[model samples]
Target chain A: MPPTSEPSTSDTAQPTDADALQAEVTRLRELVGPDEAAYTSLKIELWAARDSAFGAEMAAGELRGQVKVLEGQLAQANRNRRWMVERIKAPLRRVKAILR
Target chain B: MARYSILTPVYDPPEDVLRACLESVARQTFQDWEHCLVDDASTQPHVARVLEEYAAKDRRFKVKRRAANGGIIAASQDALELATGEFVCLLDHDDLLTKDALFEVDLIASTDPSLDYCYSDEDYLSPDGKFINPFHKPDWSPERFRSQMYTGHFSVARRDLVIEVGGFRTGYEGSQDYDLVLRVTEKARSVRHVAKILYHWRMMPESVAQNAEAKPWAYEAGRRAVQDHCDRTGRRATVVDGVVPGVYRVQREIEGEPLVSVVIPTRGSSARVWGVERCFIVEAVRSLVERARYTNIEIIVVMDAPAPAGVIEKLERLAGDRLKIVWYDKPFNFSEKVNLGAAHASGELMLVLNDDIEVETPDFIETMIGLIQEGDVAMVGAKLLFADGRLQHAGHLYNHDPFHAYFGYPANHLGESSVLACQRETSGVTAACALVKMSIWNEVGGLTPELAANFNDVDLSLKIRAKGYRILWTPYAVLYHFESMTRIPTVNLDELKVMRERWATPLKNDPYHNPNFEPLRDDWVLRSR
Candidate 1:
């Protein structure tokens, strides 16, 4: 009774700091829920986004590979066209037969 | 006793020549040889009497008279078909063989059991039986035989191979022997040349060389023979001029080291100092020096005026002792400058390089030199291309139609231009980057300074042809040429006038110059054009 004669402002501020800490703890508990279904749904959405991005990348790579193959085929066709014109078709039809 | 069936086709041969040939056959040391004489409907009574007498007297000799004249080639074929000996020998009724001809041939064949054919040297004789000159040949190596058939040795071949080739083509009479030899050599397991005089070739007045009228057909026959040989061997055969009487073989050897001299003639433009041209020279020289498999070379830079001090210093520092500067302060003449450079060359092969041109490959010199090393080739030209990789020159041809001129064509064509590009006997080459034999250059007296810058190469080529040497073009040897870089002002009025005058003189004066510019005339192009 002799030591606690007057009430101090520090005792009132100490309870307010405790109240703010309790509110932060309540918000953190809401973010990290104890329910398994909510956590699993969020994890599935993130995984789907990552999988879609990876699939898009793989499709682009396949398209590039196909373009290179087509270019090679086009070049070969041009060569064959020139060869047939100069060596085969023209020689057979236009030029006088060498046998004669 | 090994018997040789000698096939002789008679077509109104001179009485004295026929008798002499018959006497030679009668006097042969090898008595086992038989004669199969086919009379191809001779018009002369003396030929019939002589043939009848020989047939009646000797059982070894048989005469078959064709119902109608099928020509000399057909008669020879008929005689070849009738022959029943281990070896077949061909003899024209007008030519004589030595007494020991069969004996020597038999000895060579017997010694080498693998021998499919044997040939001996011959003496070219005049109609009066006077010796003109002896064509002594070297002993056979397959390489030498493939290089040139020097001995018109009147070869003795196996009968089966003769029959297999269908005897001989009728139209190839003048070169029937050549065609037969080429065919037999292709199939022959072994071939040997007896280095002795065993046959006599009669040089009659009516023969191809002596008679002006008979030459054209004879040349055509000779060309056909070359074509046939090329077909049979699966190798390209070019009909080049011969050092001797027969067709010169153009054989390519891929595996030998070549000695080369690179000649650069300069008048010292800014191009020589520092730029695209300088870079070209540096890169070409460096590539040749550093990367070439062929190590032996000498770089000759022929200068008309003194080069810039800076340029000289640069060349000295870069090349050190490998570069040799040949100074020519003479008049402005391209041919004279080249002659001056050639005079100082030490290599067995000489390359005339325009300083303006850059070599595309390190193997350019090697490829050009390889084509000419086949013994009979006098000169070779490389394929010239522009910086953009289009052809600048394949070879040269002369045109006399509108005016006397020289032209090159198929400027950017990728493949060969003509048969000449694949395998042909060309008229000449542009001297821009020509590879030639030093000996042949000396023999032909270099280039004429009068023609100088224009038609000088054509003049040199004509001289080579006159002496019976072939000028060749090789696609494998490639270079990039900024054409006529040294002739500055881009175009000179004085130079054009001079070139025209110079070209006209050679066109007028050269006797060997194709009258209709036939050298430049391509049959294929003519048909298309």
Candidate 2:
């Protein structure tokens, strides 16, 4: 709170290098503004990539489930076709035996 | 408080076996252990008397009796429930542990409290209590464990994980230990192997260890165990009985008919063989084409032309249309020759075979291809025998030395010893007759040309393993490898230095070789250090 004398002309002319450096840093900051928006957009891009991978994994799992079901159905259909062929042949063989 | 609870279930075990088992536990140097003896309603009065005597003598001994004849699984579960220790080890009543078994387990548990599971090396005990046939096991090898329960006996697990995996399954009685081990290892946070023979599995005539016929159910259960393991892990494989009893063969089916490229790098020279002047390449090619059952293979023979004159023409004549001869005009580099041959190879699978090798098994290609067909496995090697019929290359291992575990025993050696008798996971196998996936070969950038001779295969194996691929050694794929028949041996110190520098850590410590063992010997001897 003590009031000091104002800087003499000589003292003001020879400013400390640190003060000059700080002034240059502030001027550069003013020119470039802030990188906060760029970083936020970068975070958003990374999250989007993660979500895309997760969605692909889910889709692949669902497709595999559907394939497994289809395979089971095909196996059942093949078994039924074999059974029908055997059933048709069974009567035919019996009739032929009777004729003989 | 006790740190380890040993669960040993006794049925109608022989009195001597039961006494020996109990005596081993009683004589433990580590006092912080509880022997949880569960009697599965033994009809023999002596078994119960022995259990009661142990319980009365030692406060650390806990005994429980099943109402009916509950199998080993139920008895194990009952003993697990009775356990108050941090970790529990399963012991068979007929087996004996080394005096330091409990001490070793306690040491690891106390030192590294984070370890969830641990196993020790084991051997077999004859009926007369003579310890023999010690299995000096490797460190924690998940790939090897998947093929067979290499860490079967003296396996200790944290009590919480054991209880969480539901102690033991009901129907996997004969192979209850295998089932429990599979479950425990699946849920394990960390696994450790003591690398010392701390357990001795006794073999009685009626015991499953001695005779598979004693309980056919055990083999069936083992098959189911491996199949279930495959199912659980989603490793698409078909499990079947191996050539040996109590061992299972896991055959992985290939997607389609993949062409196999057989690259036999040789120097086309005529040498006197058993008083007959003949070219080895001619006969080797003939042997391969005539013997190998798999017909879908193309032979790529790389040879230096000027060294042997007309030998190339003779090889080409014998090889016929299937042969692709690459003239290796440059100085001899085994690694470069193989790489050059690989570049010319058209098959999906590349078999780096030596020209001196005579294919023994008709199903050599079929067997090796079946193994490498698994997506996880990168390569599979064969059991090679010398010209005189002694073993040459059972499986190649970097036992800190350039080589170890290659027993050139008698031609008619009993196929019982641990090393060559069964199919197992190995760190590296000699490229002499190794079948590797071409994609994997490309991935690891083929053999290191800088390592032209000595450790080219080892460097390639380490590189392949670095890519998270496993290598296997199978005895089923047998071949007679007349090792280095045409090639003159020379050691370049520069190449050796490159090898040592490239694999400094692995050279110092091989995962396939036990830490207790010295680098020069396959036999597990306590290292001086």
TM-score for each prediction?
A: 0.45, 0.71
What are the Cα lDDT values of the candidates? 0.66, 0.78
Query: Residue B195 of model 1: what lDDT?
Result: 63
Candidate 2 chain B minimal-lDDT segment of 10 residues: B410-419
lDDT of 2 by residue, B148-261 (tens): 667888899999998898888888868888888888888888898887889999998888668758988877887798888878877667888865566677766556778999
**Docking quality band of candidate 1, CAPRI definitions:** incorrect
Per-residue CA lDDT of model 1 for B230-318, tens digit only, reads 56665544555433333343434444555577787777554432112354445555655666556677888787667665566556655
Off by over 4 Å in 1: A1-100, B141-149, B209-213, B236-529
True contacts kept of each: 0.00, 0.00
